[model samples]
Target chain A: MAAGSGRAVVGRQGAPLWLRKLGSMFLNVYAMAGFLYLLLPVFVIVLFSFNEPGITRDGVFRPAVRGVRNYRWGRFSIDAWKDPFKLPDLTNAFQTSLKIAALTTVIAVAIGTLMAIALVKYDFRGKGPISTFLILPLTMPEVVMGLSLLVLFVSWGIPRGFLTILIAHVMFSVSYVATTVKARLRGFEWRLEEAAADLGASPQRTFFKVTLPLITPGIFAAALLTFALSLDDFVITYLNRGPQVTTFPVQIWLTKKSGVPVQINVFATLVLIVSVSIALLGLYVQRRRERPVAD
Target chain B: MSNARSTKRWAPWALLGPGVVWLVVFFAFPLVRLLTTALDDSETTRRLGGGGIKNFTTIPKNYGEVLVRTFTYSLIATLLCIAIGYPMAYFIAMRGGRFKNALLALVVLPFFTTYLIRTIAWRVIVDQEGPLVGFLRWTGMIGDSEGLLGRPISVVFALVYNFLPFMVLPIYVSLEKIDKRLLEAGRDLFASAPRTFRKVTMRLSLPGVFAGSLLTFIPASGDFVNADLLGTDSTLMIGNIIEKNFLKEQFRPGISALSFVLMLLILGGVLLYAKLLGTEDLI
Candidate 1:
């Protein structure tokens, strides 16, 4: 309980130095176990993505071993990765997911960034109600959000499909986008814009020159988060995606019902790779930007 | 002056307009519509020919077991997240040194994968013929007939696994923000290290725990995917019921009612929790 970085307690402690170090080691072990538990599934998913599933005569790539699910490790093969989009349904679903996620990111980030800026900078009428209203979606259970939206489309007689999925994705994700951007916007110096304006910059020029660049990091971060959420969204997407529309997650669920496809693992690993790569790239860019300022 | 005043009046709305409109049409109105859907009672009357609020009332009587089970399972998951997440968050915040951001990223990396797939990975881990269960069976720890799949503990564990990052991040943020100088001051004031930690460190991190608990609990309680994919019908949750009801036409009222009950219960619980924790700022 008392362990920390400082040597003050270390020098005064009755316990031996090794024993004190052992206490910290316990925390380290506990943390490693926690991380192991956290990453166990990711490791499984990635490992199984590489597993060569037994192709049955009917063309389904489940485990060849009878009476068991396709999760067991099979002979090592990269067949799934080599032909990642083997299933027509999987390809179609992946395309649809990518499209919705992209569109959702663009729309949510734009709307959320603007809203966040307004809330942070301006004393708008009904700001309280608006803030609470935006926070509502974040608090609402996703199932409720999906069900209600599903019902809304039904009651409104709007066809549930690609557009509905887009709407649903944008709806749930906008708040998250707003919150992320808002957190970033909170500490921003509004005086920068005023200073630009004072230097004879027009409102439009001042915003473009001063404000936009300052908030771009926040906006970028929000967009990345939104893209991930939109891409991986299943429950709401399931509710909104009519029979004709299928996203990656909905396809995975459908596949789960039929059989666990090795290709499913393949595509999922792709998603993990793509997202992690983007995150790393973003981190690298941020680090590079800060280094110059630090120097 | 009038032009400037008008621009000021219209500017914020211009910024807020599209997002607020989208939220109103999609987010806010649907919830209001959900309430009406829950209480509409048209379907209930058509079938049974009598029952006003039975849509809400009958749920407790009919599926009370499922409802209770769902709450308890998620509650246990939330508690587990705190137990597991706190130490992990503490380690990263206090001891991670230069590796904190990387550690946080690792914590969140699992989330980038499809939520369903993550649960499926657990499904693999706990399969009847899978290594873990096979080992357990071999050791006679569990009966040959007994399986890990479809168990309540499995579902709870899935929730914990899925939501652990949420709990950890907030706690990490809070812990990282704590000043080391405070601990030093406690040491100087003749407080023992353990006493300093209890009186200073943990006290400051209460808000994080409060936030993390809500973050873990709300979604876990409402989540159906973990229960659906991991557990059998014997361990169904309210989310499964809501999902089922959403599918069939006759179960419309039940769908909304069950969802409403879930929202209400969660809201009430959060309020009670906030009160107990005395974190008035959150509410």
Candidate 2:
């Protein structure tokens, strides 16, 4: 009886052990493939960045395992790093991007926060429609939105220029800010404001002291997101920007169309590092907020 | 003292005022103006108005091919992104632990670069001399590099790469919202892993799946960036065509028609997505 029971146990365990091994292997393979898919383009760019003569037999940039000579050469040449500046046009574009990004962030965040507060904190007429209307740009294609703005600007005799591009960016970015801020406010407790009112503090003073302080982080987050989004904007800016008002992205577009340049890769890597750092830092903060406090 | 109530009453408006003014100036006005210009165009009126669909009929005749190609590539690229992105999202959601943040970060990191810069990166990498060609040759994957680019594959790859995060993020959000307890309950009820996933996980993840699909499909369908960056003349996207007419002073009426149709198509897709996810799932 003991031997028979032992044999039964062994038989049952053997199949699962083998199956488990196979399952784990399959998962590992899948995970590896996904990692590769995520990293492939980045890896390709980084690898090509270091590959030099950097030119192929066809006089075009190609990847070769030819070592670190290209990196050394590019690093040694300060002018190569300053190529965007040398274009004069490129420097103007960069400054234009900065100014537009700054303006768009301020305008979009302020409006979005107010709308979010109103919609989330108080009952109002036509709130649903208001929300939907705000969300309209989020769903519309960049091309459609860009073209729509272009037509509007031209028809109004507004003249396509920096101001138009800035407005268009703020329009698109405002919705995103409002959505996120409203989401953050959903977790807010209104009883604090009620308590302040009950304790003889006026609503205006209470809100200025309490409400703004609590939501400031969310406001900041929205601002950062809007700024990043505005900085990288291309479609609307491209459509609405006047001949003399090219932004960094527009300049890059023209340059790429002319032919590929290595400096763009260097610029891209820098942009990637900065933007990703900001996004990941935000995610980290969110994660920390979600964790349970230990006694 | 009474100013408190007055301030309280007007505070929300004060908050909402700047945003509303911005939108009215930038968004609403622009759209209104665009429609009027198109409708009022003498050329568009001359071509299509006299007994036809008016301004609308003129668009198709002028930009039919551009419209068709744009939708074709967008639809194709969107489908491919879903096919590629879904499995990847699933793997990350289910299997990721300590590595989840890192992996998600990788997905979003590339998007930080300007669109033009990333597209230019591909231009460098996919060129005749770029590493992709070199790697393919080294690995015996292709006999030559000439056929690899200026083709739909390169454009599709760029689109997929650029938009993959949009697809993944929405689905990841949806997937994370799924109730883990229900998953455990399925297991406790003696359901097999695959069966539980099929019955529970898949059903609940539909909203996220739909959101991701819409996010990817809308932009991908309308995108001309990849086509412009990676394609030859034969592969112009709808966006490129519309852009040509709008900016480069070519095929004016045709571009307008194509733009109008593409907008409708986009609206249709958004409505469909809303229907699938219900209106509340809209992000």
Candidate 3:
């Protein structure tokens, strides 16, 4: 049991064995509790997704009272799941979020993947400055990014709407995509392309056959991440979304003044399920690809 | 050979062109333009043009309390993250056994949910009719009218919760990198377990703590949602102020200045902390 942590020494150092056991036991319990703390809110969110608002007063259901939020169990029902698009603002905003996230993923991944491949595949002038530039956006606060972009759009006389939001999402997402793809590119074998060339394959053929397949997983992972980032974005999108546009998070913020809607949780739960599924699918594909290599 | 060499010369630029241009135009240029906007006068007469530096000059005095509170909450949240996250990270890295990947995935699970949705959940948990409020009422901590949702502690708790994974992941990476053989070497040298942890494990993980602290603090300081949803007017953060002012056209210059000042302070603080820690590689 002490093999991993090297706490095996405490027993040898005149400390009683039981004391060491108790310490390790305590450490494990603390970690378990920490995980619980981290996950509890998410659990609550899922649980309340099925909550039918307004306790069954006699036979009819009603929305919870005005001052207090509907937080009780309130009888488990799939009303939210059945009517996920019950709120117009939320549905429209969610669709817009998905659209922007999709467009942003495509553009950002294309641009960033090329950059990452170039950076890894070849050394060139201005590499250091370019890398540093990429880091700046990642480190900058979303508030700053949002405000700055808003300023830029207003000054440029560009209307703030779906286009502006797309630009903002793509702008912020590029560096993350770059960083992820770059990290993935680092572990790739450059020799394979060379080997293909030596075997009389043309450069394009070498790329398609040797490099593309090996790099797809990284690019796919980066795309998934970019999509997630774009979808979950609130601060940046809110600032740049303007009067006409709204994303899911922005909708949630706007609706906060009114009341909590069950549809928000239902959609949120759906998103969670989709993202987790995609992640698992990615993992499965990567594992399956590696299995052949292992054999 | 000449043709291939030319392709080499142009290949990197060709690939880097779109991303670089996009960042410069959309990211870098906006920030520069934001600075000018910050320096612009409060009057809408010349809203598009640059003006005097009074926005910067008056921000400190006007927003002093908010500036201080933002840093204080972020600092406290960062400290709490290290307290909670470090042990969890250490345990998982050292003792997670075969369940390591699964546990790590679980840690990242909440991130799949939208940020506002997760925050909304916290609102439910601490609202007037929630379990936490019931518990606190039972404990005689407060009356039924006094809910848990809008308080300093709730704000800080949400901050810690939101950023705890950021603290944990980096620390876990650092802890995982601690060579097991070295710990064995410490044992062979007759160092006790606690001493070994203090000297080797703790010292080696400073970089992780450094990283985790920055991750937790930077976002926590700039965070708007946790404070906005969980706390009332008295606990409103600089981010909430930034959000409000930016939305209101009359306050753009002042808010721009505030945003610029906040960015400057964060950069300065990070540099100073990194310098004090001698983590020169952080840059």
TM-score of 3: 0.94
Please give, for residues B15-107, the per-residue lDDT of candidate 1 as tens digits: 999999999999889988888877775754448532457777788788799889988998899999999999999999988889989999999
Q: List the residue pairs that clash in candidate 3.
A: none
lDDT of 1 at B48: 50
Q: Candidate 2's C-alpha lDDT?
A: 0.72
> Compared with the true structure, what per-residue lDDT tens digits does model 2 show for residues A1-295?
2332344345532345457558657766865775576567675555434333333445555543443222211222333355534557666777888899999888888888888998888765567877888888877789888887777666668888888887788889989999989988997998898888899999799989889999998898899889889888888788889988988888777775444445555556666777777776877887898999877
Model 1 chain B: ten consecutive residues of lowest lDDT:
B43-52
Which 10 residues in a row give candidate 1 chain A its minimum summed lDDT?
A1-10
RMSD of model 2 against the true structure: 5.5
lDDT of 1 by residue, A1-295 (tens): 3444455445663456677578779989999999999999999999998776554456555557542245667557888889877789889999999999999999999998889988998887799988888887877779989998988998899988999999999999889998899999998999988799889999999988888988888888898889989999988998888899999999888878767788888888888998899989999998887886653
* DockQ, structure candidate 2: 0.46
Instruction: Looking at model 2 chain A, report the run of 10 residues with the lowest lDDT sum.
Output: A68-77
How do all models score by TM-score?
0.94, 0.85, 0.94
